[model samples]
Target: MAAMLTQFEDLAADNTSGATELIQRILALCESGAMGNTYNEIREGLNLLEDAHSSMPSLHTVIQILKSEFLPGLKNADDLEQSLRYIVSLQKILEESGAQIAEKFLSVLERPTRILTISRSSTVISALKKAHKANKLSHLYVLEARPAYEGWRTVRDCSAAGISSTLMVDAAMGEAVQTAEAVVIGADSVSSDGYLLNKTGTLPLAICASEFGLPLYVLCDSLKFSPQTRRDVTIDEHPDSEVIEKEESDAFKVWNRYFEWVPINYVEAFITERGVFPPEELEALSTEETAADE
Candidate 1:
């Protein structure tokens, strides 16, 4: 963990210089369950993000709000570190909050579960490895999660390992689920109820899979488990301004965020390193689940 933090510190020292790369790297580490080093660096780097732009009121207000109301009165590096880690762990908390509840549910399931992997995400990779070791990885299906063409990563990775896989476009999930026993996906964040917050098109996929009588499974680590209330929680829309902005579209709101969320109801199961459970049971298992990450 300390080693991970050092790497994060190096990358996060400047938000604009390579913030996205650093974030990508940090996510890679966190997904691997060896993020001890990155945890601290990410926490420390929050200060850098808060200072990313000196002129943006929205950014400034968020930082100020974090300092004043959310994590007020922090004095030392350690306290600040803990606070920042907590903030970063918001996604983690949402992703994998169950312990007791999972233990209860998981105890009833047999090994060698069949899962149809739809999206390619670090979270998906993490789940694949864990389930593979635990004798649960049955099959992997690659959804051509597109626009950015990220699903290809999953297909490539799985194929390299000789894992049986089939590639489909973003639209074929509903049809594919007919043969699929279960639909498994990775999450960018797991809402308190285990609603899978992930890439923009994930929710529709989950919905389609659900309607097809397939169980929607979310494979996540507990760090993404958010304890916060889900009352209109804001999703950060990213700058698509760089994409079509140069294409002469409307100058305003041209950009979009990198992700979207599927509410918790469609989720049938959530598998985490700690355990697995129904989405509604997340908050009840904070015991075996420790809050540490970014």
Candidate 2:
């Protein structure tokens, strides 16, 4: 557990990394014998990561959501081999879903054009790479996701990949949106109603996209879906040090929230493993299902 938690910390601390890679490392720990014999034991490991690490909701929520789909099938598996088999099965599902989600983006990126995205979503990065390989991506406009300045990492990555991209300040999202034909983002969680919880500043960018009559798309696997609504998730605020690196004068306070909820109305569609779906199309899959419902 200590070693696994350390891995999560190192991955989370890097502003450039995303939840997909984080989750993959966590699962690799499990595959290498970190997972215990019973389903509860495995879940306890995940719970510890959820409680202790500053990881994103999507990291834990993806497994939690998949638990509902796969755990019941494991009920009849009484031996360790059987238990591990189910674990391996779940891992395969996640990996394949990621590939399919990337493919969806490749299909959508039909021409060489500029796109605007903020923060760093592993899902978004993978898709962009695929689109670039197909020669469909001309440029990317990345916002300097403030405090952390994750956009610098995005620019670095795009440049390394031989894709043309520009980094702009957070406030320049409105300007970026004017030239971008569409806006794409990654989600930390998607409510049953299709609202998105992502890095701070995403909501305003979506609003800008809406006002400019541009479509905003979210790229994520189906595992990112959460039964919880926006009200159920606790949105955490980061330390003021991330915002102001000065004397501890109590003259003013800084509300540095790392994430915010973007209403479903602002989103045009979601690109999931299944395919691109309008917000309403996700309703059936996002609904909280009972054992019987499953």
The lDDT leader among the candidates is 2
In candidate 2, what are the lDDT values of residues 156-245, reduced to their tens digit?
A: 888799888989999999999998887888887787655788888998999999999988889988767777777777776678888887
* TM-score against native, each model: 0.59, 0.83
Error of 2 at 21 (Å): 2.7
Q: Any runs in candidate 1 off by more than 4 Å, and if so which? A: 1-24, 27-46, 49-114, 129-138, 231-233, 239-255, 286-294
Superposed Cα deviation of residue 18, candidate 1 (Å)? 17
Cα lDDT tens digits for candidate 1, 1-294: 566556545643422221112344444544332223333344454465554432122233434544453344244445555555655664354335432323333443366655566545555555465555555656677777655556777778776765667787877777677767777776655555445566667778777877878877675555456554344346654456434545555556554544566788888877776666776677666544644321
TM-score: which candidate is best? 2
